[model samples]
Target: MVVEYEDSLEESSYSAAAHEPQDTARLAINASRQDDLADIIFLANNRRVTDMVASMPHPFTLEDAKALVKRSEAGHMGNTLFAIRMKNTGRFIGAIGYAPSMEDGGACHLGYWIGEPFWGQGYATEAAHAMVDFAFSDGGISTLTASCHVNNPASRRVLEKCGFQFREQSKMRMSGNSGLVNVDRFSLTRSTWKALKAWGQAA
Candidate 1:
């Protein structure tokens, strides 16, 4: 089914974070809507959660969610964005999306975040796998990149499972924490993903 959401976001500014899940939590990713504001605020209100993402505003508020939904509903030209939800219950877990990165020579960057309560269930991996598969299969994206705080091993594992290769380590000012932090970057090329698929190294 074609995904649905009401918000539009800047590809350059859609935000970033680490999201993962266990092998059994099959998540259904879809577009973000205004109605999700309450859910978003409730789950994203934690300081610990915000500290790890690069773009999420700490004290994530109703206004923020409103603006996100309003702008996102308006539209972003080349970005494919969405919210992550439980497949069966349609419960909101977090968010995931891709935006074209001009500095990366037009490669799309993959980003996602799952609620703390939902972590370790492979939901992040499931969402990433779904997004990566769609981006290549239907969106025509050739390359995808991602990053996580150097301290976040589970987040890195999510990318590894999806076939992203670790590229480098760097430091950046994290928006959520308002501080500079170390991070590890990774990337996956369309060719590599296809090869992995053929060899069954990735799903």
Candidate 2:
């Protein structure tokens, strides 16, 4: 299930530029959306999509969404995992953002998910590009890491578009489960970010 891209980006080459995250930039990232639990639950209950998620459990409810909002808000020191919303309709589509590990002070992990109804419309790529730009900007990032199940081609594509380079492949225990699953890790550094910005401008 571990799919990798032939291309690679150096962490030292991406430029760190200030990028104002816009809610209307294809997709929006929101946090502290405990009030939107009902909608979140509705989206979470979509069996068509959750079947693909590595560790997401079934029968999502309003309470589950509320707990997610609460935990995501209070868990990370930098406040990761924002709600993903549509710009035009102003409807919550899913969630996105970085999650930091206490074990790795300088590294942060990026993750996201979208409702099935919103799939295959370029929202993931758009939001991921924005998130990467925001993270690599000066005063924004030290290092960023992301991973996906080997079978998650769409997720891998999102990482590729964000200029991440494959670091390694390993197994990790899934949430709400006891077994291990294969995953591909990708990483980016600030200097590479600067270069990436320059390349983007030149292109």
Candidate 3:
């Protein structure tokens, strides 16, 4: 899923380090950089990648990548943007973060996308866990909302694994596809996230 938001907040940067017990042990959620533009364009230009995202334009150009980086630097309505990277190699594999859900009162909207080459790996889930943890613990978000194209089961699984509950299905215009598409919405509250964390720790 992709998210684009407006309004402004002072820029800030932080990192959320995650240690996974499986193959994704090296994942790190860090701020996007100017250096990431080339990599972003390369990975995001694929039709397979854009079709599943809502706002990302296909043929993802340098200008598009630059605009994204600028937004990350500027911060969007209390939004936090992170680059999903390999801690060991410092390679940008994907992007994930959240923004205030203006329509949902105090809720924040979570969104993410992984490169085509990295599909089927657990990187998305691992990064999502880190983002969710950061959102609740450090980002001061009381609730998180996310949505994905109805056909994208991979994304649905990521949200499910992260404790988001199905909320609804709605239609939205996808810029990448240049048409309207059906999307499934999901939400996770702070209390639920805390319980899940406590359960995991207890286990």
Candidate 4:
């Protein structure tokens, strides 16, 4: 399924400067660039990374990375993809985006991945937060869903941190495993996001 953005939304709307205090910001999300091909190939080719994602193919190659950048340029499955870049150096460290889901009511699915070298540093959670905000505020989305392999506790933590609540357990085809795997699904609604934002401001 492909989630379609409103025609009123421009490509520039996908660019987000996440985390406050520009100089102190750790990262920013922006449209993917051709220059990011080498970095995407280098980071995405790792088994440790692709193994965690469902659609990413193992033995990831330069052509695959080039296709990814092209998709980002042209819109991947009707969804805009973003590069997760370090604020200080402007280096691409990962990718993140939302896609259409089979779920009723126009719910979209959120997905992201970071380089193996950048893991354990809270990049996933930061990116998730930024993406969630962007989806609700700028993307005109009402519902967002996500899932992670049951064994990936780190990913589950990232979803929970972004205010996604557990929904159900399901099976999905993982390209790395070449079979269906158990996954834990989660979802968040616009109302819940608004409440969370209010609570955070009050706190």
Candidate 5:
């Protein structure tokens, strides 16, 4: 899918962070919507549940949001974040994207969060599946990895539902904020994806 957005930064960099899986059929990752900051801030600030997302907290201020927009616009952080919008409402319901890994070639970490009001509606699953498909198909990525805080079962379920397998336990030393948190690593491979599709068809 050729997902185009007006907020795309002209400059960006990417690298592999973890074990690179060989796969095809990756999603077309893109940038966040520039003009929709007000709505993003409103949803993010008003929704306490959104605090589950690392880096964003309840009462997210405009200052913090401005920084987010700036970082997204700069596009040099190796993180390709995109806003999720409803085709009908054109409202920004959430965000999802891949953070290029610093450790391995062709490997990227997936991250996403949805607004509180939109939970349990399958949007997260659909968006995540689209991203996985892009990573494996379009990005030519062999392996895609994601980490969720040990306490975040919903996030873990999202990853598993999309075919990622539990890999290992690890800790994330997040920058400039929360010190450290236990995280669970999950991964998916091209062969596994193929098998998943085959299995789906069989079922």
Candidate 6:
């Protein structure tokens, strides 16, 4: 179901930020909003977060955050971007989503991140699970693929926990940071996801 917020942010659609709703769950995924500008900037501006994701720009700014919302809202046929929020506090911690293939392949790449401070707390795993469930159930995608820098063990664990099997190894171009880095690839097909869910529900 699509959720909506009143967007207390009064400035131009891209001018400022808003207050996240308060709840008690560990994490929740929802559409990015104009009011989330400050949190996105505060959490994503760190080098620790920026260095891991390929497309993210370093020294991330409010304008960068604004641009992201615009791009995500533009709506690719099979792509979606979501905000990872702390349920109890309504704070934006990071982002996650699938980017559709330009070739119209029945697959898309999964990507996600959580703030440095929020790491090691299982938030990434929870967010990834929600995204995977959505991709296969509502999104109607056949396959989900993801990659992690060989150096990033934390990310590798998250993808593995989400049921992505090791596919291969490849090199990825880092956005702001120049050199290419070796990345471990992983994928989860719809049939596998259904089997796993069946076992999960049975258990």
lDDT of each: 0.71, 0.67, 0.76, 0.77, 0.63, 0.74
List model 1 lDDT by residue over 59-81, tens digit each: 89898777656644553424756
On residues 1-203, what C-alpha lDDT tens digit does candidate 2 reach at each position?
11111222434322332223445456666564666787788887776555545446666667678777886566433345667788666688887777675434548877777888888888887777766655654344678888888888988988887778998898765553446778888888767766776666567
Candidate number with the higher lDDT (1 or 3): 3
Error of 1 at 151 (Å): 0.7
Worst 10 residues of 4 by lDDT: 15-24
TM-score, prediction 1: 0.81
TM-score of 3: 0.84
Write one digit per residue (lDDT tens) for candidate 5, span 54-150.
5565567787667666655555333556667775556777777777665334477887878788887767777787666555543355687887878
Residue-level lDDT for 193 in candidate 6? 74
User: Which portions of model 6 show Cα errors greater than 4 Å?
Assistant: 1-25, 101-106
- What TM-score, over all chains together, does every model reach? 0.81, 0.78, 0.84, 0.84, 0.71, 0.83
* RMSD, candidate 1, Å: 8.0
Give Cα distance to truth, residue 185, candidate 4, Å. Answer: 0.3
lDDT of 3: 0.76
**Quick one: ranking by TM-score, best first?**
4, 3, 6, 1, 2, 5
Best by lDDT: 4
Compared with the true structure, the alpha-carbon lDDT of candidate 2 equals: 0.67
List the candidate 4 regions with Cα displacement exceeding 4 Å: 1-24, 76-78, 103-106
Between the candidate structures 5 and 6, which one is better when assessed by lDDT? 6
